[model samples]
Target: MALEDIPRLGCGRSIDRIWGTIDRPPTAHEEQCDQCQTARTRLRRLSKATRSLRESDLHNPTMEPRPGIKNAIMDVVRAKVRRGSRILLRSADNGTTEISEQALSSLIRSAAAAIPGVHSRRCRIEIRSAAASVADEDHPTGTTGTSTNAGPRLIINLRVAAAPGIVIPRTVEALRHEISNAIPASVGIGAGTVNITVEDLYDV
Candidate 1:
């Protein structure tokens, strides 16, 4: 049954009860209640259908999205990628600063994509738990400069697709140079290792 067809307060309780009971043992009343059981069955089926549709949309967008669907779809994609591992960019008297691995990866990809023949792929940023030391630059003294006071050091892993006939070493070096200049200045964190993997090659 479509969600709208299910009465909002059916089964002698609000739909919240159905939501609250998902993936857990149902209460005594719910176990014997026909309406609640039926709703749960329908909802589970609906959930599976939703997943199938999402997979289809992801793999089969061969043509331009219709009307305003492109932006809507992109918004959903961005929201899904927004959260991941986090880093302490800096700390101060009042509070601490932080950024997600997603943000850091985006920065790295932007740098890599700016190069002539590199297509950015998956990127990851990790903090070495054992590498935390006092960064010199964290201060509340009204300085506009980025904190030299350190946070945990980062390890970056980047995968890219190289275009045919490009100088691979030179391209990777350029990505490294760009990343080195961009990451620290953008977020007051230091990097320990940047592992670049040339995972694929494609025609230009």
Candidate 2:
């Protein structure tokens, strides 16, 4: 698993710390902290899954996901659920539209993965306070999925892994362009900047 994908608790400690304690007694701190104990329980289930996968002969023709990858991704999604981190699609006199971060993340990831030779790793959307963005003065709400630029201008950051031997610069540029166009269309708001980081090169 990529080190960056490690799941961290709300206290900022990685869950790997919990996994490390599998063979030994829990520390005094861990024993006292309910958060660590709860995370440990979840990690134990994941540990069982990892052990099972290690014993299996199955292998993906492309690349198999590393152990704990799903757990780590689920942690982020659960965090969003707890915090209710959401984006305002658009604000109009009629009403305001909003989407949860988890939903938007899914949409953005799907869009990125659609690009050939690339696989999306992470996507983050930052909302910026801005002037009202209405499609037209007459029909402020606009048509379905046509707010164009809705409530707030957004700054989007993306990290993707490209297949080895691909033209990194050209592919990333296409990714950036695609995201800039897709986000506004998918949601009501527009992305002011789409920042792409080709963080990893994976075997084809």
Candidate 3:
């Protein structure tokens, strides 16, 4: 059932129970109600986000917010919290459509993390013109005049931690292949490069 149907499920107590804000377990009515089940799933995700926040603060005890930083963060958090992970996609007709970047990244992350020894931590998406000048590279073709434009190429960078037993080169290759296929198929954006950086290796 949808969230709108929750009130019809007799009571809203299941949400409180899921968060441990209530002392009792899910009552019989909540146990059988599909609306309550959906609500519980959403609430659990929020709970995990809360725990992640706590862990993050613990790791960076010295990092304090600067002026206006809190508002900037809340703006981002509120947008995602309300609408999930959506991004604007431009159309040739000058109209825009909404697409779920979160959905694409989730698939990519799942594919990478499914590899036996790899766990993905972060994924960043960048779109660059195919003919864009390489500022960091030494090249005579570097643009000084008004340039021609090419279609955008999508680049993905993943930060991951690998387990000790994995072979480094093979692991990176597997990750790249998985990401390459997932991005084009899921998001309709062909990946120019799928870069993986092994930031940590866990002990066996």
Candidate 4:
């Protein structure tokens, strides 16, 4: 029978049965059968290659990510939080007195410049605002009173250039803490968050 007409071999078959009753090399009939010859050659090559690869050493014996990877991931998360907390500020009196993104950025620059041990050239600030409304609780009339709300809350992100001799962790913490405190004190609205990024070190 042609190879195609013969029943296909199953895994449960005996080794002798799988090799097909022939004790010798492929016979004229088997060799002449193109389909059987191709299958035999493929199975032989696969078996040899698998055996050789099983004995090979291809995996690293000791390889791992650097210890700083965790810190890097944390830094990225802090950056995202800072960006998310951004707020835009505007004056209530005139829409013309609006705080453009560029203006807010300039304000951040000015603020950072005023701080000692910081490089204004390498500093950046981003701000965003959200409206807040609250019922007036201290009205003399004691009625519902005129419900009032502050315009919006501002969130700022600052990246300051650090000098070579500065203690990076302490400097970053101090900058963030100070900026957060200063913005609310000056602008009359609470600063939601302040993120400080140190991008590069300056010699000065």
On TM-score, the candidate that comes out on top is 1
Tens digit of lDDT per residue, candidate 1, span 43-131?
A: 77877788898888788967446864764575457547766557777678999888877777778877786788887776767676423
Query: In every candidate, how many clashes are there?
Result: 5, 1, 0, 6
Ranking by lDDT: 2, 1, 3, 4
Q: Which TM-score value belongs to model 1?
A: 0.55
**Which segments of candidate 3 are over 4 A away from where they belong?**
1-101, 130-151
Largest lDDT belongs to which candidate? 2
Q: Return the clash pairs for model 2, or none.
A: 90-151
Candidate 1: which stretches are off by over 4 Å? 1-84, 130-149
Ranked by TM-score, top first: 1, 2, 3, 4
Each prediction's TM-score against the native? 0.55, 0.54, 0.46, 0.39
Write candidate 2's Cα lDDT for 1-204 as tens digits. Answer: 555787788777777777887657888877888888898878788888898877673664446678659957875865566347777765689997888776777777778877899988777777665543333234535455344343676677888888998899998888788777777788756667788898988787
lDDT of 4 by residue, 122-157 (tens): 234433334232331355765654433254544455
Q: Cα-based RMSD of the predictions, in order?
A: 11.2, 15.2, 16.2, 13.3
lDDT of 3 by residue, 44-151 (tens): 788788889989997894776776587457546644764465544445686756566555566777788667788777677665654563443355665554333233
Task: After superposing candidate 4 on the true structure, give the runs of residues whose Cα lies further than 4 Å from its correct spot.
Answer: 1-97, 121-149
lDDT score for candidate 2 against the true structure: 0.74
Question: In model 4, what is the error at residue 169, expressed in angstroms?
Answer: 1.8
If both were scored by lDDT, which would come out higher, candidate 1 or candidate 3? 1
